[model samples]
Target: MEKEIKVSIACMTYNHESYIAETIESFLMQETDFNYEILIHDDASTDRTQEIIRQYEQKYPDIIKPIYQVENQFSQNIIVEYINHRRAKGKYIAFCEGDDYWTHPEKLQKQVEYMEAHPETSMCIHAAKRVEAKTKRKIADIRPFKESKVMTVEEVIEGGGDFFATNSMIYSREKLAIWPEFYFNGVVGDYPMVIFGALQGEFYYMDEDMSSYRVNSEGSWTQREFSTIAKKKKHYAEVARTLDEIDEYTDYRYSQAIQNAKKGHQFYLLLIQGKFKEIRQEEFLDLYNKMGIRYKLTSRMKHYFPGISRLLIGIKLNLIR
Candidate 1:
């Protein structure tokens, strides 16, 4: 008979041949009292990603269950989470994308134990490290609290999508099974999913860094969408629309926080388009006021001294990149 699965890890991948092995290795390194399974969906990778997965599947047939798609599902607008949710049998489902990896071996074990004991947490998230993909240099730490604490729905709404890394998230499969229509409607999955999950119960946060979130990794949404100004504008507009819908769906209970998050993207939208005057409008005044002196100065320079600012910005971007 098959062992009782306590957790199911949902990993989505596309053309991550170079990184998928490490991702799978991290999952296999987990030490847990209960059985767990890894569910990987490869979206028709042209690379050797599927070959590597096949090797692992043969070695650990029961634990590594993968869906090798003939065509790309994400391009067709299919949410991989919903597909994996139907196949997941464990009580809880955890997320870790192909390009990201868990840093702690006990990550799953510790989270499962905590959730089992508390019984009130709708989701479990831990601190994660954000690293530069090419150089593997540490950029910043992604942590909301100085130490671990249970977070509220209001906090999650105010925190937005980047509050926690996707790899550090785990939630009850039952709660995820009934995700609202708004969850599906969002341009991005993680933010809305967390908002709805927050509605279910309080979020339990573990302060330790247990995962690594790769920034600008190959085939990542960030690299694709933010590669061009047009794409970034389109992405932010969709996000703003989704937030508006979310506000309405929640009956405007979190309207202030939702608006704050929405206006932030609008600020970026105007800033990137060189519409500095528009950013000071009533809709974005609060967000504008919150900007640091450096940003304010940079905007002024970019607006009034476009030629000089463009040269300076080019040098700055080159240094960072």
Candidate 2:
């Protein structure tokens, strides 16, 4: 009889011909004594992505299971649908995209052990190093929280500091089953998942850096700018709807959700105008006030000034880059 797998790695791939192999190799190199299975869902790719997946499937039949789609799903709906339909046997369900690869072989082992030891903890996440694809240079390091504790809804509303990259999180099967459909529908899926996980049980933070997140110009949602005002408005409405759904919870977290929604509203306005200069002092002040942030008009003026705002935003972007 075969031993049961302890972890199910849900990997989604689109047109990642260049990086899929590295991603798969990282999973293969995991130095764990226990059994684990990798479930790969390939959204129909026009490139050589399918070929690479096929090669790996042949080489690692026992550990790798590939779900190849003939017609493009285009959206994450099919990917999430596949994960739900297939039914993972493992106690823990971990996620990683084909474009992102793990840097540490003990990544899964360490997370599994932590969750196993802490019954109250529903999820575990570690830090990730962001690297530029072309230069292969280390751009920024996203470090995890040093202390492990139950995250409060208030903290989440305040935009809980550093969240584990979606690829870095390992969640229990019991908690995953309760994940709402809204998570997959949002422009950002990871945030809702984090919120759901925290609601279920306490979160375990591993300060160590164990994953590499590659940022490139191609095949990224951030790269595509919403050119039309209608598109921008639609995006913002979706964000608002998502936040409103979470607003019913009467906790500090609800404040954080409102603040996040306010920020999203401000950003959408900026994008719709096609220039950040279009944002007036009054507009930002109104936004801050609506978000419940206490600030004077003078401070708002300083923040809206082109030169000052540019310098501050430039520094922040540089830090991320």
Candidate 3:
């Protein structure tokens, strides 16, 4: 009989023919003793992405199972993630998008070992390399947590809880089955998923930088999200809506943190759309009052003279560029 799969590698892709090879090779490169399977969900890419996936599926028929959609399911309001995730037949579910790849061959080995050793951890993530897709420039290395270890909810809350890298998380299948309705409908993917996992138990962290996260790639979500100012505004509002759902789901246990995060999103919306008049609104006061003295003063300055504040912010952003 075939060995039972211990982890299901959940991968989703669309129009990533150039990078999908690396992604599949990375999965095939993993040196894990325990059985794992790759579930590649392709949502009707017009490019050669699906063809490439088919090639790999044939090469590793035992380890690679693919879901090919002729009609793009995302456009049909089908929850691609939920449906694909339900297909997972493993104790752990790990995610890696088609455009991203694992760097270390031992990544799955290390992550699985840690998860097996610690039953209470709802999920775990590690550092990942953020690379600019066009220039292939090494932009920054990120490890949201300070060090490698189990993290408390308070720690996660205080840190804005946007810590988990999308592909880096490996979560227990048991705890993940407790997902709420908001996760299926109202939420905008990863943020709420991480927050939900945090609610169940502590999330482990690994300091190792073992994955590559492509930024601003063609046809990628990041590229589309920042392609225009309107999209940025929409993205921010979507984040707020997701957090609102989480707020209800958690019964306001992380209310303060949720509020702070929403304010940050709203602030970004103003920046992207030049809605400076919104500064005088009462919505920001709660965040303003709780902010540090310097931030409070900054908020006051921005509120009183939004034009000047906008000019100054523009200058600062341009300087950074």
Which residue runs of candidate 3 sit more than 4 Å off their true CA positions?
A: 154-162, 271-321
lDDT of 2 by residue, 123-242 (tens): 788888888865556877876456555556445443432345677988888766755666656655666677767777877668878898877725544444344566667766776666
> Which lDDT tens digits does candidate 3 get at residues 270-291?
6444454575468765544555
- Name the better of 1 and 3 by lDDT: 1
The most accurate candidate by TM-score is 1
lDDT head-to-head 1 vs 2, winner: 1
Better of 2 and 3 by TM-score: 3
lDDT of 1 by residue, 27-86 (tens): 999999999999999998999999999999999998999999999998888887788888
TM-score of 3: 0.83
TM-score of each: 0.89, 0.77, 0.83
Local distance difference test, each candidate: 0.88, 0.71, 0.79
RMSD for all candidates, in order, please. 3.0, 5.7, 5.0
**Colliding pairs, model 2:** 153-253, 154-252, 154-253, 157-256
